[model samples]
Target: MTVVFVLGVLLVFVAIALLAMALRPAEEAEGLNRSLAVIEAIADAPKELRKDLEKPFGERVLEPLQQRALAVGRRISGADAEERIRRSLDLAGNPAGWTVDRVTASKVIGAGIGFSFGLLAGMVLTDALTLRLVIAAVGVVLGFFAPNMYLYQLAYDRTNKLQQELPDAIDLMTISVESGLGFDAAVQQVAHNTQGPLADEFSRMLREMQLGMGRAEALRSLNERVNLDDLKAFVSAMVQADSFGIPIAQVLRVQSSEMRVKRRQRAEEKAQQVPVKITVPLIFFILPTLFIAVLGPAAITIMDNF
Candidate 1:
């Protein structure tokens, strides 16, 4: 009887331990669910509550912060912004005009957009004060320099367009010269007929020449303003031909043919590069899809059997 009693006691203790283990997880899970529900409630709070939460801590806290931000804007705006941007553009050999009002407006727009995106992203990703502050600082810096970046992009695009149009302009100039027009007349004709950055530049050069600047000086100025190697080469060729009394028509014909050949070779080179560029996407995106298509069903069947 004693042996049976001890055995029954052991079974009871085992049952109790098992019951405790089973209930522990449920209790913990319930607590976790409650915590999560609280968090969701906080997140889904009304817009007014959110605004109140986002408001600056107090008048003492917000006043200084507002003053500092205003100071930053004033410093950035007053630091020779126009001169700096104009010099950078000039160094890039772009003669496009930029206005002070445009620059200021661009900076303001950039700052606003940056601040908004940074604040929204910070709220979405984290609730950490340090991280939010860092994001805001970065946004402010980016915004301060955004106008300069935009101007650089514009200059680069304009330069590229002019480069692409140069060969065609040269070809047309050659045709005009070969048809018995003078070199200056051919350039004027190309400038008048074409509508692009290059044509505009040529038109400017022609105007300078008409205003008593020597042909060579006007062409050199055009070369400097455009800052294109091809234009420089053309200028050098013209200067040498003029000095050596070479036929201008012959010089134009030779340069036009060479330009066309170089253009064709560039096209071929880009075409060849396309296949190599496609290989990376094929390996990363296409191969994985193919593997999934081929092996997925077989793997599923094997797992089911196991």
Candidate 2:
């Protein structure tokens, strides 16, 4: 049994080493090929066009740094790093120039900055090696995750705005459909009339459909991007209705009604939690201040009498 276990472990280690060796050469060759292509293009281009084809100084300088940082990030990141970051970027409205590569580089840069600052602060505040190491480690962790945290906040705020605007958008669509407009026209109306993430998404969906994509596929893309339960439900209903040849107007009406009800229920749920949320502050802050104010003068007087 021991021999079999030892052999299995050796085999696994050998497999991993072989895979690393195989992949490393491919990555190196890809980088080399890109450099060669750029050199060949530069050599073949006319003088006038060569100036235009040449990259900016900043780009030339940052490209190598970004590659290094990206390497570091990939080493530290999980297998799903690209997809996860892409999904986050989508949820965050896909901010301009914020590609997965840039985000990956930022993670490494952030960690480096964080570690430097943490070590400096630790040196100033303490001499203990263990404490300094702990602080520095904490800084590294925070720095590494800062980009992700920012993305999460952006996604959260955007999702909330989408949820809040959805019911109104649905109502508008329902009215337009009832007034004899086609479903796509109603969606265009929402896209043009409303504003915010929902409007932007609808506009994109319209574009997708106009570019020969199916309505159901466009809607599924929208749903995947938004990550809102209400939006998901609405998309599913619309897809089902389209698939079964049901009336779009009736489907819009049902969704609009449900949106209103759900919005109301969400409001009520938040209202009901107010007291529970306040309890912590009441106990830790307000009650103590009140007791101090009420009892202090009486205690002083009693002390004088005694």
Candidate 3:
């Protein structure tokens, strides 16, 4: 009770301090453009404007919590875990501001939430200490793996989108290239005219090249970012074409054809699995319902006669 009281007091004090800082007026802060300076300079700019000038709530508050949790996560996390998380993030297209540290911190946060919930529920539902501890342990395992599972799903969804969009992007680029634009210009055209993960990647690659990175290096990075075999093959072919002076249009046309073929194969594979996927549903749901409907009237009549 004493510890809880003290912690509550500390939380109240921190909340008060945060409110005070938010209300306190700033004075001649630099680095902001003139409009932002004027916005903050106002004695009574709306809360949103001041918010824009200050460190975002996430950065100021959540970031510290994440960092603290990440410290605990790092203590328990193996070196290979971090590497695998980074690779997974790459496969997920590295959503803006996502990092390995954030994911580790999320796992820690999730585990704590699960443990607390499990502990509370166990205490409320039963008096057995052993059972409560078991529940809490299960919670810990589920929470620890939850973030990774979600990240994997995200990567899978993004990769599928990339695959779906690849052939169209390639065709667009081929058209642009054959229309007298150079390879880079054709890529720019595709970026401008289309939209998807693949286009975003092409745009990023263009920007990297514009910033003085070699084409081969930029293309290699793109391949590293995505986890698709078809994309890897296309990148390899593009690199080779660039290196050997093969026409860009020819390379794109061939890749487009291959991508279409792969897309069809994927569709057929998924189609073939439909029956297998439906087996459990049919046994547990549809078949039982049909059997009951077909036999139910006869069974009732026979029971009446008996």
Name the best candidate (by TM-score): 2
lDDT of 3 by residue, 65-176 (tens): 9989999999999979889999998888887878998899999999998898889888988899999998888888888888898889989999999988888888888888
How far is 295's C-alpha from truth in model 3 (Å)? 1.0
For candidate 3, give the lDDT of residue 116.
89
Tens digit of per-residue lDDT, candidate 2, span 1-306 = 999999999999999999988778777989999999999988988888877557797788878888999999999899999999999999999988899999999999899889998898899999998889888988898998999999999999999999999999999999999999999999999999988999999999999999999999999999899989999999999999999999999999999999999999999999999999999999999999999999999999999999
> Estimated TM-score per prediction?
0.64, 0.79, 0.76
Tell me how far candidate 1 lies from the true structure as C-alpha RMSD in angstroms.
Answer: 18.5
Predicted candidate 1 versus true structure: per-residue lDDT over 1-306, tens digit per residue = 999999999999999999988778777989999999998987999988778566767565745654555555556676786676555565354544555544555566568778888877877888998898778777867986786887677667877787689899989999899888999899999989999888888888899988999988887777766656777888889888988999999998888888788779879999999999999999999999999999999999999999
Best by lDDT: 2
Error of 3 at 225 (Å): 0.5
The global C-alpha lDDT for each of the candidates, from Candidate 1 onward, is 0.79, 0.94, 0.89
Error of 2 at 105 (Å): 0.1
Candidate numbers sorted by lDDT from highest down: 2, 3, 1
Q: Which residue runs of candidate 2 sit more than 4 Å off their true CA positions?
A: 1-64
> In candidate 1, residue 287 scores what lDDT?
97
